[model samples]
Every structure is written in C-alpha cells, then in structure tokens.
Target: MSEEDTALKAIEQVVAAVQRTQREKDAEGFLALFHPDALWTTAHGKVLIGFDAIADFTRSVLPGASWDGEVTYDVVHTQFLRPDVAAVKVRQLYTDAEGRPESEGAPLYVMTRGGDGRWLLTACQNTQVRAA
Candidate 1:
C-alpha cells in the first residue's frame, strides 16, 4: 500500500480502538490512545488540558457512566496536515440498549504520529449535535 493509505489505515485502527474502549468502558484503554500532552474538550464544554487531567476524569466517570446504550465512533473524514499529523473528523453515535439512535456527536481529533510510529490523539473536541 502507498504511504498515505498506510497512514489512513493506522488512523482508522486508532478510531476503532476508541469505539471498542468506549463500548467496554475501559478507561485505561481509552487513555492509551492519547498523547501525554493531549488536549480535549468534551461535548458538555469541559476542557481537559493534559493526559493527567483526562485520566482523572476518565477514571472517575467511565465505569459508572449510565450510558444506557452503546457508543460508536466512525471516522467520517481525515486530513493529513503533514506526513506525521492528521486532522480526523468522527461521527459519534449513542444508541439505546436496543440499538436505536439516541444522540450523535461530531468529534474532531488532531492526531500525531509518535516516535514509535503509533498514532496518538494529540488534541480533540467532542461536540454534541443538538437538534434545533
């Protein structure tokens, strides 16, 4: 495969892991996707400035999150900012326990390729799609 294709595949893998981790409520696994200095803004407007802060939040909330449904992350678009950086847009869906859609989100992830060649979530914003 070409270089760009390989990168895209790697990015998709990261996103898939996100879906899996969120579904399983595995906070550690979810944290594994981030860069040490990553920045994150949640749909509810909470901003997490670094991995430590993010970890604290995830550990405290994920396990007990009622969710009441399944969550999914689908990569809708990806833009390569450089050979090692990418801007990825994801469609986040929350479904009822019976699989009915409940809510949706638009998340933008700025990922960077680490020195070890793994893609890391460097910066991100998760925005809820509110109905007008």
Candidate 2:
C-alpha cells in the first residue's frame, strides 16, 4: 500500500476502536485512543484539556449517560495536513429505544501519528447537530 493509504488505514482503525469502546461504555478503552495531551470539547460545549481531565469527565458521564438508543461513530471525511497529522470528521448518531433517530453529532478529530506510528486523537470537538 502507498504511504497515504497506510496512514488512512491507521487512522480509520483508531476511529473504529473509539466507536467500539464508546458503544460499550468502556471509559478506559476510549481514553486509550487519545494522546496524553489531548483536548476534547463535549457536545454540550464543555472544554476538557489533557488526558486526566478527559478521563475524569468521561468516567463520570459515559457510563451514566441517559440514552435509550444505540450510539454510533463513523468517519465522514479526512484531510491530511501532513504525513503525520490528519483532521477527521465523524458523524455520531443516536437512536431511540425503538431504533428511531434521536439526534446526531458532528465531531472533528485532529489525529497525530506518534513516533511509534500509532494514530492518536490529539484534539477533538463533539458538536451537536441541530436543525436550523
């Protein structure tokens, strides 16, 4: 595979891992996808800095999140600023208990390939998608 293909594959794997972890409400597993200095903005507009802060917030909310339906995260697009950095757009969907669409989120993830060649989320924002 080409270098770009390899990078995209790695990034996709990271995104997939995050989606699985989140769906399972596995806080530790989700946190592992982030870089130590990661920054995260919640769908509700809360800004969290650093892994510790993200962990604190995630641990407190993820397990207790009041949602009846399933949650899904999918990569919508990707733009590479450099060989080692990519900006990924993700679509987050929530369904009701009956599997009806409840809401959606548009998340932007800035991922960086570490020296170890692992793609890690360095910065991210989860924004709710509301009808205008």
TM-score per model over all chains: 0.96, 0.95
Best by lDDT: 1
Lowest lDDT block of 10, candidate 2: 64-73
Runs with alpha carbons beyond 4 Å of true place in candidate 2: none
lDDT of 2: 0.92
lDDT tens digits, residue span 39-112, model 1: 99999999999999999999999888777888999999999999999999999999998999999999999999
- Candidate 2 displacement at residue 73 in angstroms: 1.1
Runs in model 1 lying further than 4 Å from the true structure: none
RMSD of each: 0.9, 1.0
Error of 1 at 126 (Å): 0.4
* Model 2 lDDT tens row, 1-132: 999999988988998898888888899999999999999999999999999999999999888767887888888999999999999999989999999989999999999999999999999999999977
Q: What lDDT score belongs to each candidate, Candidate 1 first?
A: 0.95, 0.92
Clashing pairs in 2: none
